[model samples]
Target: MTRIDSLRAGDPPRIGGYELAGRIGEGGQGSVFLATAPSGDQVAIKLLGSALTGGDDDPGPGFARESEILRRVAPFCTAQVIESGLLEDRPYIVSEYIDGPTLQQVVEGEGPLEGARLRRLAVGTLTALTAIHRAGVVHRDFKPSNVLLGRDGPRVIDFGIARALDAVATGSGVVGTPPYMAPEQLEGAQVEPPADLFAWGSTMVFAATGRPPFGMDSLPAIVNRILHRDPDLGLLRGDLRDLVAECLSKDAARRPTAGEALMRLLGARDRPVGFLLSAGSAAASGSPAPPHIPDSGDAPALSPGASRPPPGAGARSRARRRAAILGAGVTVALASGALVHALTRDGAPARPEATGPARPLPEVTSVPPPATTELRLPGLGTTLHENPGDTARMVSFMYDSKGGSNHYARVRGTNRFEAVAPWQEPLPSPDGTWLALLPWLKESTPQPYDFVRLVHVPSGREYIVRLTDKPLQNFNPAWSPDGTRLLLTTFDLSSGSRTPVGFAIVDAAAAKATLVRADTSGAPAAAPFAWSPGEPAVALPFGAGPRAGLRFFDLNGRTLRTADGVGEAAASESPFAPAGKRFATGCPGAFASVCVWDTATGRALARFRVPAQSAFIGWYNDAHVLLTDKSADPHKVVVMDMKGEVLRVLAEIPREEPGENRGTFLFHYMRWS
Candidate 1:
């Protein structure tokens, strides 16, 4: 064991063949020291605290666990663990010294980040978590202080208390900071990956507002607020509000998984609309464009009216026109100059079109005929597919203009849409009343890191379903026809390349998930995997390559069967139809064609050729599928039946501005009881 007295400042002790310079920081468990290697490179060495070292019993097991966890995660998502050993009655671990300040220090020094910068921080941190969770460990303590804002990107550190799947039984204690702990952890319940998500969410709040969601005060008060109160997200913008809200959920199961959180952040940053101008144009000395204008075709143009009278009918009219032109030009010139100045001051490249006039709105397309139309819910901003019983409704995952995580919802009657709580993955339930959400986890932790959450729409209740102990990324959740079981896909990166890890079934009501089968073959490109509604099996199209084919797997991670003759084809993005009698898959071209498959016999049923340059496919009833083609001069939404017959042309929703590409419109699924 290493002696504590020898770790004092100015004591030149050789460790790992490096001379320790001085103590940098001391904590409850260890003291960090600035050291120089044989090559003179700087590194930080942590020695166990004297409290634990002074005990008669050996405290090497804890250090051994930390070293093993670090070694397991180093290949995937952490700073390299240089060396670890024992010396003079104390054990020590040495790691490369990260130069950047901790996230806590950065936030304290710079206040809070806003706009694009905040979003970037959230994305970067979540990406780190994604890498960490893929390695099958749960980071027991994740907070701003443990994250390093390095020049390359964010790096997750301090995995001294991380727990692996096979080791969680031996790891249970109040190990993390109370304010950042998940509700379950605060309540003394067994913690899981979602606990890390809670910490991440609180950490983000600190990064954005320079204050934790639970407020900084006594530990008891902070823990109390974290357990019961909701986070105030008024200060966040873009997708951050939703992302942080999901993270700070009192119910740990409601938070999004790291992978899903990363995707939501990406979607918010890559929104369809351009950057919005600030509200006051005069204050900034610029002409702000109108937010939106209604389209009015064939309306009589209004005449230009002015107060000053002209000198003559000929000369006066000429002079008035000249004055009008000059006035418009001057406005444009001033605005352009201001914009250029602002860009230059911010060190941003100036746009050539900054001086141009705002473009006119595009002509509105003719409204499509209402075919079996149901109630319209514009307040929801997206349409919903009502269930056959009218007891539940289904809507697609959509985002609010302010940065918020996208989630699906189910509504009944005229009631407000209640968000599905637990499943952060954003996959809908078969009955369309609940959704599966993957709560976010910390990076720099080991795996099997899977957690599933279920949301009850009408009541807004969240259910936490513990799935596995191994740190694996789970997604694309689908409910079986009987509604007794839920099917999902897992992606494992433990062996290097991302492989088709496996599929599993969870008893939805009991909150028990069991692995059915796992693919031991080489890594496959991640795609949507669906369970046939009528059969007790699932189909995963391995894409076009050597391992390309529609492979079938039972619930136990075993490939029960395989089919040879589907040619080499890629899978589709949309979900499969009910009963799995017929499903749609994407095809290469300007538009994605539909390839129908017979689930019973595992054969091709029929091929529906879509309109050229189409993008998305939606089911209108069971017989007709809706296709939207935005690539043409006048975009169109065509309804095609299974016989390859074009039944009708729906009213086109016109593009907001000319030359703008709307791509495909999403028609949400709803059912009426």
Candidate 2:
């Protein structure tokens, strides 16, 4: 039976006259729900989200195109589309429900399928593709998760990005998943039936072996292999292996069509209904028992260039037109905060003038709580053993092991530690209500894809902020003080080496992004460090090569100010002070000092030289700066006053041995609201 998650707060109770039962699943474009029809039969409802179509009320041509494409495709081995309409402005489709786990889930739980089962899946999915292509529609996105193993047989689902054959030649950017995408899709070329065939081949590899044919590590490596190298088929053997290899050919023109591949698998033109699929050698092969017979429909030759005039709608270009549909709602929610704040606050002590010779530098102190192995936060309260739970303020600390360096989050004020997502680093928002997941920060190069995923800490609801219309690896994400916006540095790596593209300012609440292309001709490119607390600008270290000092950039890519004599502060949560009056950075050249600069004047205000190997860790408050003591074992997070005196220690954490090639081990904190 297919598992359905309870509906979230934002999910609609009903759509197009059907009462939604619960959520079946969610994907990049939208969420799918199990629904009850008026006739008492159960159906599946899909509400397109993200940038799929126009405003909820409009249901633009893009939505119309999707509905028409879904309606035209034959339902022999695919989910049959029942109806599609606009409900409360969002366009949704109703389709027949398939009660079973996805191919991905099944294979992951029970390992690879054997002879008859694998062969049936291939034939069934290919039949669906043949019918779809014959109907003048292309299943642009086909992969393992899209294949549902129904009790009747395997059904191909989710035509969210499908296009009528006539619209395939438009200027569509990369649209499918990286691993299963063909070379043509990666290069943004015209997609035809061969692309789906390529995906089918890749999905087969996943079913035979629990991984994509092209290794699924970094996006750049996967894309490069898809375009240049041959696929690793693993244990896939015999005639199917050769078929998949041909289907995965780099040259799309060389791949076999759905009907041709189907014929080759069946080893005949067309088998009769209920014909023994596992006869002779197939029975002797010791594979699983023969599954239900699929539609032995005639393998009609599906032409790669088949086409017909599309009905009253455009292709993905219409999606671009509706990109800002959700922008209005987000803008209204984030309109409260002021862009810039005054550096000084009322009742705050003013910085004393540099009068007598500097007093003796205060000795750094390390204070451990009752437990040496656990770090504690005063106001964090009791600990809860869950991920990003409400009322749970968690701090993530890194530890090194034989496998590698990974992060584990400890509930603030308690000794319990919890695991978040694996392989990705989670940076919590300022308010601890959201978490941004990205590739490990140690790697200079990012995975390089389209968007940044921000997960709401309390509800675990996820929102995706696309960096640009096209693919660019975005990195160095820093949350704004209010946690409503995020700043990221973008890079273009299609040509191999990472090249400075620009910066992207993302409105986390709005799911909208604006790309600002800065001048990269003068100084070497630098990652953005922090957002200005008072204004719509960001801090980036520009004191390198031909340029000197730390550069401040406004949202429009214009330089606001450049403070000389200081560089980027390593390990700093943020470079800006809470009051937006002063910023912190490392003194230019060496571990000599930490400098504080006036935000308004871009002038150095004070310099503090104390403990060795100590790095800046943002402002402890408006008047004091936080620093990490890493010169010795059992590192400590300490606070320092404006008078170059170490006031006290915040937390003392046990230091773990750094793994081979794993960079510095550090701790990060997120305060719960």
Candidate 3:
């Protein structure tokens, strides 16, 4: 590992819960310091530059983009972000530190890569891109230097922030290196995921040949070569050569998606798709696991001394040496996508070939079940099932804006109010940085559904997603415990209340949504359900009134066959814990009683009649049940230790009206910070 230096003259000793060890790396946007977490884990804390963070009250896009993206694509092929908070008014983010050398250092020092080694690098990086895309994000600055070849494998870093910065106009200083830039980028055009593919091709070419696709040259010359010339592959052959060429296709539409690229790189038509793979971690008990890590031979590792030249040597120097090495030449007309053409230096034709024949890469529409689950949760009963630290630590609420046009939310007990329409409810993410707003399109109108608009509260940035190709409506957006995915119920708005539609799992970043088949009974519609806080199964309402029972579905929305009695009981109004093995709900027509059910069997394990006119709030933990005694003076909530003995009264609230309940969190995931 590279040695960690001591704090410099300007460095702060501590930030939030992390203590600085020393500066490990620095980039154009910020400085990265090796730090120690309160729990003693090693972390890399990045202090963002002032230009990106914005003024004290208003931060720019890149300031929060990386954290938001990392939060959504964690535990995959990335250095997961742990927490983010300001230090002395400047923003800082701490992420799990990956000890490894960049792809640049490895290839540069070890010479050109080939065979299994090259295959591994390609597969690993491609898989990383796939995961990022799956989460609704695009890595605009995807180059060798941004990839860390760790002990476990390659991890993609600096994703969203780069994209946001790269979007800034070129004359003001573009974010990415010119040699690795797509032609469209150089032409000052709009960039997207397709741009990443072009950069990926350049990266692969550099890795395999120890030179950029375009030979190293002056900036003007490199720009000309990129726009007008075809990369000189020079002896590069086989499937690798073909794939790289396709990735560098002048036409963006002709390029394959990250997923498709991965599938083709592994030869989908040849293997079982995952014909060769690395053993990846299993999914959270009973949930769908992520894609496999491609199995490949051991590649050369980056030694501590393998660190590249410092900033004093300049980023352009390393970028030039590792990116474009083409001779000087210059122009071409602007076009769609990130590619261009040119008239040669001596006014010759650009090149005879068109980025190969426009062959399409195989598309992987969905990720197939790779392996059987090895971890099973004991569905003993429901208690507090989710990580409630963040929610439990603060009381989130909404208030009238004194007859103003919109309502406001007191986020995280910060006393800082954010204006949200009365039609919206502020459900903060587990990290407390984002708030998911479920707004009724027409609150005064009697509509059957609503859509969610995710807002980064601190930055005021929002991601409004359509979730469909047509003008469809969605409702009841539920945030998963990790806040990476959202569970939504789709409604055929035209169908009215007489029918039921289905459910969908949305990638919070990319806005890509998949419809899940939750209604096996073929009903026209169904009520929205709450995910069991942690796993894939959700407790959904199948029918109406007392006749309605709860059905469980996996993340893909496939019905899971449980004990026959399980679906026979009515779903309670209280929220299910994230990983609860048991659940507690009050009997519908009761003399006021609380009941705990075996989530897997639909069998009641315990029942306790509470004081008159009371309702079950939720389970405090696996051993305790929380219920409200409305019959008591006003309404008092009490926690019972499962043995019918009252342990403690948690809180007291005003009596709720017959059809109105002031609390819904009793049914949602909550965590104490």
Candidate 4:
């Protein structure tokens, strides 16, 4: 009776000698149902869905062989297999029903588990794994979704993909969730009992933190973290943390065996333990980490005008700065010279306790004290400068080096300094706290997947903004001036054609996106997009196409206006000015000049001619702009006035002629406050 859904239409009332009661769950393998056996005992029935058939004429002799191996597994901390047979030519396996919810369900509904409960889960699953391994079977997929919280104790279930020890142990194909898979499994190396131990460690981390240890960012990012970066085990303290870390070791040979891990868990306890609570009995829990939106299903509606500040926003700002280290590379100084902390736990300090009754305000303060202003800077190539100057402390930029292309960010003075996912471009939020990334995949062909990945730099929390049920391809992610929202263009690929569908506005904090479906027939392949600096309107190349100039649209995707006077432009810098009164773009003509346009009327404001070699980088301020002066001898980042005047130089760049600083982009990209 633990969280069972009623049987749906077309579901058989009776299979073999068992009567179906209700639905337990459905997954990649098949649907599971709660049923009563011939002996009138409660049992769980699994309708086979995997391709494990030996021949078409038979209902999978492989199923029988696999079920025999599963039956050899001791019932200790495992679901005991009762029977296996072909019912109506569909392969099925029956096992003793464990009345409980999955660990994944518990964590998602409640939060993370801690202390003794956490220890018990770790112990129980390891016990089940030990038995499975001793029986010569390797549970290939041992994630949170597999561990069931039964009334007796935690029981491991669904070994549909398990392979016997003597079977073909290695294959080119990889099966299992990306985040929970071990390094060897990902590399297509020989997977053994050690891989299960690694999964156990990952599950333990997920149980304690309510997040995958490597983070649930992207398939590429998760694979990168699993292979390279150390896990972000949030607040998993003491001896348990050490054991889990050892289990998660990248080297599979170094990871303890299932039996060895069981011994470690059992031997560590100094106090006697009683029975653990069933999933239905345990109360929901919460973590000290920042609240995260669920990954699946529709996200909660975002509150209007509600803003979530980045971590370490208040008094703990300095502490967070001290802990800002690159993900896996050279450390950078945030405060003075301190090691960067992992993005595992909340860096915010504990709130102070109330001393006594509240006191009345003495008098009206002169004016509220100004907010704290911290220094910030960007890392050019492998080196980072501590002097932030007057630039915004939170900034995201890309630099290419011998190590390859990487995206770096300085949030509240901390840098996601290491290239978590190499060759990816990250667009920083206006405040420089959150980052919107289009995670790069090394696939042979273009994918139809459409979703924007957002990461809170301070806390290392990640969320996805999904707009549609159908597959899509998103491009041009532009953050609003306030950093609370994002504007992106969506493409439909249902007909195997990449057709321009419409645009979407994503609520960053809420992890929710609204699709403004449109008929973009005349839009260019790559159109320039931007959110209005003042109002909620967005300018995009709509159905009328680039010939229509900048077409403005509201949240409902209604066309507000079309400024044809702006004309067709090839934008090389940010289109909108900081003050929102004026915008700039590279003029489309043989002369190639930087043209300023009025935002309200879209009329030409001013034109500043530039050297053909020099390119418009971005707006320096409302009155000035920045240009990359490659025409200069040393190559400089120069500031320019609205008029055709070079005001001052910002930074002089060292030229890489041929043999010098190969594969390094030093000071090639720059941004200011």
Worst 10 residues of 4 by lDDT: 331-340
Highest TM-score: which candidate?
1
Model 2 scores what on Cα lDDT?
0.58
> What's the true lDDT of residue 639 in model 1?
57
Query: After TM-score superposition, what is the CA distance of residue 135 in candidate 2 from its true location, in Å?
Result: 15
Rank the models by TM-score, top first: 1, 4, 2, 3
Give each model a TM-score: 0.51, 0.43, 0.40, 0.46
Give per-residue CA lDDT, model 1, range 357-423, as digits (tens).
Answer: 1221122222223344343334333233332332112344332212233443434333344433211
Candidate 3 lDDT, tens digit per residue, 1-673?
4446778898888888788888877887788899888888999888876665344454434445555655676345566667666666466777779888888888888887775456667777887777677677777788888888776556677776665443321335455788888888788777778888888889999888888897778999998888988987755666668888988877788888887786555433222211111124121222222322222221111113222111121111222221111121211110000011111112111222112112111221121112222211111111212122211221233321111113234334332333343334445555444455554222211111123555543344455433422113455555666656766665443322313345666565554456554554633143455666345666565543334356666765667653332222222322343236665543433334545566666665665555544444454455654554545444444555554566554443433333322211111223412
TM-score of 2: 0.43
User: Rank order by lDDT, top first?
Assistant: 2, 4, 3, 1
Per-residue lDDT of model 4, residues 472-507, tens digit only: 445455666666777765654333333556667777
Q: Give stretches of model 4 more than 4 Å off.
A: 1-394, 400-402, 411-424, 442-449, 456-460, 467-471, 491-500, 541-548, 572-574, 632-635, 652-673
lDDT tens per residue, model 2, 260-378: 78645533222221111112211112222222122323121111332211122111122232222111111100001111110100111222232222222233222212222333432
Alpha carbon lDDT at 615, candidate 4: 49
Q: What is the C-alpha RMSD of each candidate to the true structure, in Å?
A: 21.7, 24.3, 28.1, 20.4
Output the lDDT of residue 326, model 3: 15
